[model samples]
Target: MERMRIAVAGASGLIGSALVRSLTSDGHEVRRLVRHEPRSADEVRWDPEKGRLDPAGLAGCEVVVNLAGAGVGDRRWTDEYKRRIHDSRVHGTAALATALASLDPAPRVFVNGSAMGLYGETGDRIVDEDSPAGTGFLPELCVEWEAAAAPARDAGVRTVLTRTGLVVARGGGAWGKLFPLFSAGLGGRMGDGRQYWSYIALHDEVAAIRHLIDRDDLSGPFNLTAPEPLTNREITAAMGRVLHRPTLFPVPAPVLRTVLGEMAGDVLGSARVVPRRLLESGFVFAFPGIEDAIRAA
Candidate 1:
């Protein structure tokens, strides 16, 4: 593999941190964009909210990946939190794209973070990169989020929008919450459990990102989900089978709405998303099955 200089925004995030480790361990020069003072030579200080990033910090970097964004599941979806979610992704993307555009010899690739929530509530209707954006806050947010990367694309950089799905991991994200609950025998499916969940194991998720970075011929939106998406009930059974727990309890949709407010829709929503472009690009997933993903998680 050819080692390259890469700069990453949101270097502290769950996916970002993992991606940095993968890159650096492979002998690639990885520069981290941090909000605080640079703690080391590898760290660069930048304020995405203020639209400030020094091009000098990213000079000569062959690839720039912007995974910076507010965690969608970090808190309840209040109006304030919704705005934070929207602004963080848009501003961070805009900052990175604009900075890359201004570079005399800009980076060759720009991988901006996006989510499968772009196609909200698919309800078992399988969708791909060509699918139209669904109607809702999430869809709208994703539209704007992807649009913010226009500067890099217009500058002739190979731009990729990774429409990531639920990442099954041990320490953070949705799976993080699920692990503890299932371990304690308190885990169960939500609603009628018919909701389709398109997920990717964290391992595969990182691998997909690296694949995108390496593929010079590939650009545009790629759904970073496993090929076999399962329904919520099917996932519950798999979790039970993997973790050796009982999948008896089920959280009703009304109770979820009462507790999660606007966020309930996301949990109850069904998005049978497929990674058509990613697969076509020859990226392979290590954990394509929910059972294997749960085990990995």
Candidate 2:
């Protein structure tokens, strides 16, 4: 638990930035790995597509948190953008894994990013780390992304793939996207709103990453989500209550299907993921449920 050297890729991202802040607060020496020249004092550079990186930046580090990848929801899944999504994850992961493997003094631990989408549409089933992977575009992407990190594991580094869920924060992440319409009484169920929506708060997501770092016994995929999962309607209702608003305007299923196309699977499909491994590992959630999380955040 002494001061540890940590290098975080995609340090500017929602999760990565939080990890940097948390590690620094915990008295860890944290360094940021950026895609471009960081116009500041605290950054190292890397270009994944070009297969370039300064592995020296990762040297002497005890932990390497890989949070790099294109924003999954940042763009509509056009044919080209879909390719970008897949490439951003697989290529970036490959570059980092390869870089880490070739380093003389490589990291002892690698916390790579994955997603609950790896389980695909599970309907009402509760999935855990040991559950078999599902079949879908998202699942395929997650599989490849994690596979790209195999070299690091082979190099004797402790590796964990965080199969994360919807991360909700008041001013950021998925909650920020839905708050406006719901708070304005213009938001309602999407499709039937019966589809499950597994989620975690920004606070717990950050804390869980740190917990993973501290728990040396953990490896492989761990579901980074709250123990209590909810349906879309359930989440919407909780948000509306927190904001003192009414969610009366339903987004028709046809509209979503039309706009999202194959991507609509993300919104329509169900994923009731559970943090079973983390829970069994004696990890406790700061926000175990939607109501408590919304109020605290």
Which has the greatest TM-score? 1
- Give candidates' CA RMSD values in order: 0.9, 1.4
Runs in model 2 lying further than 4 Å from the true structure: none
Clashing pairs in 1: none
The candidate maximizing lDDT is: 1
Candidate 2, residue 233: CA error in Å? 1.2
Residue 33 in candidate 1, Cα distance off native in Å: 0.7
Worst 10 residues of 1 by lDDT: 46-55
What would the TM-scores of all predictions be?
A: 0.98, 0.96
How close to the true structure is residue 105 of candidate 1, measured as C-alpha lDDT?
A: 88
For 14-80, candidate 2 gives per-residue lDDT tens digits of: 8887878888998899888877787765677887555577777777888888888777776688888
TM-score of 1: 0.98
> Candidate 1: global Cα-lDDT?
0.92
